[model samples]
Target: MPSMVLLAEYVSINGTDLSDYCRKAELTTKVEEKDVTTYGSAGWKELRGGLKSGELALEFLQDVSASALDSIMWPLLGTVVTFEVRTDQAVVGTSNPKYTGSVLINGWNPIQGSVGDEAKTSVSYPTSGAVSRATA
Candidate 1:
């Protein structure tokens, strides 16, 4: 297998493509671990998968101008919105699988940095439903 470099990542939220302002994007899915240790004379513990959940984290180069990053995200602070992310902006296929799901916009940091620092924002949102990966 070959390694992949993240030069052009695709990120979309609520039908809006925000790839230009996004610097980093990540999607993670996991299942809850449930223990079911029985009285089977075995001294080992057994585990099972339970609930499934996911989360999406993004880092953006802030652009607070009119109709820019701030304006677009501020209005979606308290809602569940759809999102999609891929390794590259090119057509989705075996090399570039797309991850799509809904995330709850539970938090935001419009301004947080020191003087003379570059404007940027990092946020993590919990998924509201199933996260699917497809290549088409």
Candidate 2:
């Protein structure tokens, strides 16, 4: 297959376990078999939202052509563990990306007649206060 890669100006990743540990630790004090309580229920709960959101982003990427898959899934995801942003309308991007939103596929990718190196553009949006992103 040909090479496909998505680009974005920003990316973020979130993985918090402190609360989980604290809660579980507290629970253990109440139960006599506290040492036996090894299941990471709290951690699992926190991951649920992220997993669901990521699934939505992947489903959206399915609409992209095979050639665009790389730009939409590989490098951008590898580089960005949390959130992603694209200043330019390239690859997969949207005009309004929510905080920690999935990477937005280039929504306005077909623009032309610009200045500066074609490669210089990263994640960008006009002064419309819109939200552009690489996934969501």
Candidate 3:
């Protein structure tokens, strides 16, 4: 049988716990493919791996608290920071797999709202280095 994980897991950014405020989290990895076709007998094109990149998108319930706002605003608008995502709720020691790496905030929308909807913010960051996965 295959195992399935819930979305209500844990995620932390620069040591601040944002799991409670986060409503959605997505991680994407992409690799560039380059054509390596040469003058060969085969007419089919060949391809080679070029580069790899990773991105993370997060949606959070807007919070006015100093910790929540400041933590996210600064990193999203200012500099690169470290982020971690876990497969479980446990923050300290756990057997769940965790992804950790540094990322530069590429885009941030402070507010997304309408008349009867919840106030939310969506932020996207581009991973700087290799995103490592390990069990803690």
lDDT of 3 by residue, 1-136 (tens): 9887776678787777788888888878788999989889289989988898898888888887776754566555656888998766865464677888988866667668899989888888899888988765
Compared with the true structure, all predictions reach lDDT values of 0.94, 0.28, 0.78
lDDT of residue 128 for candidate 1 = 99
Q: In angstroms, give how far residue 46 of model 1 lies from its true place.
A: 0.6
Instruction: Give the per-residue lDDT of model 1 (tens digit) for 14-93.
Output: 98999999999989899999999988939889999999999999999899999999899999999999999999999999
Ranking by lDDT: 1, 3, 2
Give the runs in model 2 whose Cα sits over 4 Å from its true position. 1-57, 61-67, 81-97, 101-136
Top-scoring candidate (TM-score): 1
Q: Which ten-residue region of model 2 has the weakest summed lDDT?
A: 20-29
lDDT of 2 by residue, 1-136 (tens): 8563443333222221112111111000011222322366643432211111221121111223453432333343323233332332244435533333323323323223356523111222111122233345
Model 1: lDDT of residue 24: 91
Query: Model 3 clash pairs?
Result: none
Off by over 4 Å in 3: 70-72, 91-95
Off by over 4 Å in 1: none
- The positional error of residue 122 in candidate 3, measured at the CA in angstroms, is 1.4
Instruction: State, as a TM-score between 0 and 1, how close model 2 is to the true structure.
Output: 0.18
